[model samples]
Target: MKMTVFGAGYLGATHAACMAELGHEVLGVDTNRGKLAKLEAGDVPFYEPGLPEVLRRNIDQGRLNFTDSYAEAAAWAKTHFIAVGTPQKKGEFGADLSYIDAVIDELVPLLTDDAVLFGKSTVPVGTAARLTTRVSQLARDVDVEVSWNPEFLREGYAVADTLHPDRLVLGTRPGGRAEQVAREIYASLIVDGVPLLVTDLATAELVKVSANAFLATKISFINAVAEVCEAAGADIAALSDAIGRDPRIGRQFLNAGIGFGGGCLPKDIRAFMARAGELGADQALTLLREVDGINMRRRTRMVEIVRAASGTLIGSRIAVLGAAFKPGSDDVRDSPALNVAGQLQLNGAAVTVYDPHAMDNSRRLFPTLDYSTSAMEACEGADSVLVLTEWPEFVSLDPTSVSDVARGRNIIDGRYCLNRQDWESAGWTYHA
Candidate 1:
């Protein structure tokens, strides 16, 4: 199989490389020359565990290539995947679809033969139908089929998730050839028993958003319970452990922390709400507003915890232990860790931040805060050590060792990753 993936961002790059690894010839297209050059040179611009190796190996084997020309991409392959970003609109909850629109406007007109465009970016429901109409207008004599094949790759474990997805979904018009083409492209996975759910365009479009909404609701639900646990002086960790034992309510996203803030969850739920409102079914998803509020409140609550621990925010030095949204990746988009660091800085506290891979990205997003090369360096002379993202290094840090470098012995476990008994045993005042 031969294919071209548009947009060399996180999702696109990984999908392109993984497709090549699956024994398909793939070309990655992007307008950013710098990003394309990085991919060409076998470098991943962003951090994802095991991605650089897979990308470099595929490039070395001559199975994957990159380019900036849409005409060249259209001419090279009959199958295309749109993995562009659909970020939340500025000052609005709806998704910004200009990137997807650009891909359609640029590629469809240049198609010299029959093709199938599989949409991988998360978007509002009805986008596939809307874009199907758009393609009809832009395409010429040759048939161009539009299908919705939304991606469900998590940021940290994207490569594995892509290659061995729990399930595969294809949303296409009834009686179209898109399903046959998609089956051929993902034949390897299908042979391995990865369930493929074929559905109408509208159902496929709704699948990704609904999954994200459920996940966000689960996370916020646990965080909301954590709020109750706080007021009643109950141990959330123990309560979570006990409730998680129930076969019905699993404990996957139940970790009571500063809450989720990545490229997907925050924007996806908001877009889901905004789209529901546009469809006049806004009342159905109204509780998501409270979910969004609960997630954001956790960040503020973390700040309050720090303030109370320090007794005074003015001139306090706070060492923030994580900058990325979650461990195993360096993505800081809407990161709860960085958000807390920024808020602490605004409230007259001097903040030093450290993350294994997110430091460079965090610096670009937030330049005012101090950055350190090591966790101990960030903790040096700090009034309180805040564990924001539960990176393994931070979770396993020896409290006694950190105590030697710090001016104060206050430990705030925002992610609930730290062992309270060990920190308390080390004579440190612990706050989770």
Candidate 2:
């Protein structure tokens, strides 16, 4: 199968490369010339583990290519996958669909014959049906079918998730050829025992957002428990360990940390709530507002903890460990770690951040904050150290070595990654 993936951002790029790895010829189409150029040169614009290798290998093998022209992409493949971003609108909770509209507007007019457009982007319910109508209007003598096939790739593990998804979903109208097309596209995974759930378009659109909403809820639920534990002088780690033993509640996102923050969870929940409100079922998702609130509060609470640890934040030197939302990726959109660092900086604290892969992106997002090449360098002359993201290197740091660099041996484990006993044994005041 040969396909063109429009909007070559994180999702698009990964999908394109992974499709090629699945023995399909793929052309990644995007409006961003710089991104297209980088992809053509075998350079990934973002940090996703294992993606660079897959992308480079596929491109080198002549199975993958990139372009910025819609005509070229339309001419190259009859099947198109919409991998564009549906980010939350500014000053609004609903998704801005301009990009999706733009893709259809640009690609449909250029199609001279039959085509199938698989919407791999997370979108509001009913969007696929609406896009189907729009495609029919714009396409010139072309039989274009629009279908919903939302992606479930996590940021750090996008390549693996794409090539070997746990389940494959294809949502289309009655008598449509989208399901057959999807089967052919993901024939390899289907043969590997991956379940394929065929459904109506609306159900497919809801799946991705619902998954993200549930995950956000789970993280916030644990963080809310962490709040109660804080007030009662109880240990969250011990509680998590005991409850996680039950098979019903496995501890995946149960780590009570600074809370969930990435490009997906925050915006997805907000959009879900907004969509529900528009549909007159707003009360059903009211708890998600609390989930959103709990997540945001964790960042503020972390800042408060830092202020208390440092005695006075006015002239404090704080070392922030990890700037990305999580380990293994350089994405910092809505990152709780960076939020904490930015808040501390605003409060007159001189903050230095260190991350294994996110330093460049962190600097781009926050140019004012000081960044260091390594954890030891960031800890130099710091009043206190705060582990915001649970990167492995930060977890295994030698407390004794860090103690020597910092003016004060004060450490706060925001992610609960540090071993308290080890730090305390090194004559450091440890706080979680």
Candidate 3:
């Protein structure tokens, strides 16, 4: 299989490399020459576990390459995958579809032969069908089948997810060869027993956003209960453990934390709601408004906790232990930890932040805050140590060592990942 993946960002880069690893020749197309150069040199622009090796190996094997020209990409392959970003519109809940539209507009007009363009970007419902019409207008004499095959890759585990997806989905229009083309493209995974669900275009576009919305709802639900637990003085960790044991309510995403803040969950849910309203079904997803509210509230709650821990935010030296949205990846977009750090700083707290992988990105996104090379360095002379991202290094930190250098022994576990007894016994005040 030879295919071109538009937008060589996180999703496209991973998909391109993984497809090449699956014995396909893949050309990653991106407008950013710097990003394309990085990909071409086997250097991943972002942090993802095991992605560097996969990308480097595939590039070394000559199965993967990158380009900036849409005409070159069009001439290279009859199959194309759109994995561009669909970020939320500025000051609006709806997603900005200009990136996808750009890909379609730039790439479709160059297709010299029959092609199948698969969408792996998470989009609002009816996007594929709408784009199918647009493709017809631009493709001219060339027959281009526009289909939806939304991606479900977690940031840190993208490689594994792509190489061994739990399931495969393909959405196609009537009388199109997308189903056959997609199956042949993913034949290796299909042979490995990965379930494949074929559906209409609208259904496939809805699946990705719906899954993200559900996940955001679950995280917010747990955080909402954590709020109650705080008032009643109940242990959210213990409560979560008890409820998670139920077969119907699995333990995944149930951990009471500061909240989920990544590129996907936050914006996807908002776009989902906005799209529903546009479709005259806004009332159906009204509860998602509360879900978004709860998630944002969790970040404010953490700031309040930090203030209480330090007695006041003014002139306080706070050590923020993590900056990435999650532990395994260095993506700081809408990161809850970084959000709190910024808020604390805005409140006149002298905040020093440290993360194993996200320091560079965090520094770029937030330059005012002090950045430390190591966790211990960040905690040095701090009034309170806040573990915000639940990284393994932070969770496993020696409380005694951290307390040794800090002016105060106030430890706030924003992720509920630390051992309460160990920190408490170490003469540190533990707050989650």
Clashes of each: 0, 0, 0
Q: What is the C-alpha lDDT profile of model 3 across 1-432, one tens digit per residue? A: 999999888899999999999999999999899998888888999999999999999999999999998889999999999999999999999999999999999889888899999999999998988898899999969899999999998989999999999989888988899999999999999999998999999998888888899999999999999999999999888998999999899889999989999899999999999999999999999999999999999999899989988999999999999999998899999999999999999999999999999989998999999999999999999999999998899999998998889999899999999999999999999888
Mark the 10 consecutive residues where model 1 has the least summed lDDT. Answer: 246-255
lDDT of 1 by residue, 1-432 (tens): 989999999899999999999999999999999999999999999999899999999999999999999989999999999999999999999999999999999999999999999999999998988998999999999899999999999988999999999999899998888999999989999999999999998898899999999999989999999999999999888988999999899988889999999899999999999999999999999999999999999999999999999998999999999999999889999999999999999999999999999989999999999999999999999999999999999999999999899999899999999999999999999999
The total number of steric clashes, by the backbone 3 Å criterion, in model 1 comes to: 0
Clashes of 3: 0
lDDT of 2 at 136: 88
The Cα error of candidate 3 at residue 62, in Å, is: 0.7
Q: What is the C-alpha lDDT of each candidate?
A: 0.95, 0.93, 0.93
Superposed by TM-score, candidate 1 places the C-alpha of residue 3 at a distance from the truth, in angstroms, of: 0.5
TM-score of each: 0.99, 0.99, 0.99
Model 3 off-target regions past 4 Å? none
Residue 153 error, candidate 2, Å: 1.1
Candidate 1: the clashing residue pairs are: none
Give the clashing residue pairs of candidate 3, or none: none
Evaluate model 1: give its lDDT.
0.95
Candidate 1 wrongly placed segments (more than 4 Å): none
- TM match of model 2 to true structure: 0.99
Tens-digit lDDT string for candidate 2 (351-423):
9999999999999999999999999999999999999999899999999999889998889999988999999
Local error of candidate 1 at 207, Å? 0.8
